[model samples]
Target: MSILDLFKKKPKVNGIIKYLNLEGWWLNELSDEEREIILNIYSPMGSENSIIEGEICSSSQTQLHFFWGLIGWFNKPELRHIAYKLISKAETFIDKSSEPLDVHFFYSTKLEVFYKDRDLRPNGLELAIQSCEQQIANAPAAATAFKQKYDGNLPAHKGYAQLAIILEKQKRYDEAISLCEKAKSQGWAGDWDKRIERCDKRAKA
Candidate 1:
């Protein structure tokens, strides 16, 4: 047998679930040798091809698992670009598929990352807004995901507030107020009332 045949095959679903149950211990507690072994085994599943642009595949369920597994590396400054690229591909896959609204949370999260990094790519916010709108369109699913999955980060509501603020800045009071109301109804716990009142007064003036 070849040298590659000596290592065990990739873990299955139960193995992944067990690893996740360790709550970040897998990476946080890994020794250099163990880490190297994992990298050698799984890197090809999620890694990009240096020679080709956008060559990473996220079209299948297995690939999505790989993509998500790489998300933990997003905390590392050096590996953030890889995380960004993987999620970008995942977003495209989501756009073309019938994925649930909650799956699009990364649209805002990734945009926030790019914004903080001052590396907003062309159409990034546009994509985020589109995904936010989709979430609003599927209110129940988004709300449940916000409460349970996101620990109440409320990405959809936050995205609406963001768009509302932009509209308010543009003096589009009606649209801004509409979005503010949507955000409020979608469990936004911010000072949207004041903004809505301001929009109302401005719209009447």
Candidate 2:
């Protein structure tokens, strides 16, 4: 390639860096200042430390989509894949080096994101169900913060609520109702009765 061509060409970055290189895709049209602000914000998020710290809960949502515009999932379908890749990279290190509570929170937040974008991705809902269910089955306690650290609103069985809500959305009303009932039996701190009642009304109607 000629010297001028080399200079004009964008740098080829791999892994997480490529995903943030909006210059080639989305940011070329944006002003230099606009691009700089976005890059400054997102570049840190893609770093190893920031990614590992991304734990999702109702009180403290995941960091991946702190910039809501970044997730424009339906408009920019590629963004979700970028998110999935980042999450996958973190998963490789979760069991290897992360605390059990951190791993638990990661899965919880992933479950929320997958289900939230169920319409965009073919396996979104399925993955969401599995994420919450896996946490509920294996490490139900880890998702909780009993010390009132980040709001102990739904300790020990938040996954149950998440999974049941997804099931409810899918119109599997009976399954949703049953799951809520189970949470009620376990003494979870959620409006389980309300959930069951809503599902029952929907199922009957």
Number of backbone collisions per candidate, in order?
Answer: 0, 0
Report how far residue 97 has shifted in candidate 2, in Å.
Answer: 8.1
lDDT of 2 by residue, 72-128 (tens): 222234345555544554454444444546656566656656777777678877787
Q: Which ten residues in a row have the lowest lDDT in candidate 2?
A: 67-76
Candidate whose lDDT is highest:
2
Q: Which pairs, if any, clash in model 1?
A: none
- Report the lDDT tens digits of candidate 1 across residue range 15-99: 4323324324343454556445444444445445311123323334343343445554463455556556556655554543433
Task: Tell me the TM-score of model 2.
Answer: 0.53
Using TM-score as the measure, which candidate wins? 2
lDDT against the true structure, each candidate? 0.55, 0.56
Mark the regions of model 2 whose C-alpha exceeds 4 Å error after superposition: 1-39, 43-78, 96-98, 143-158
Candidate 1, number of clashes: 0
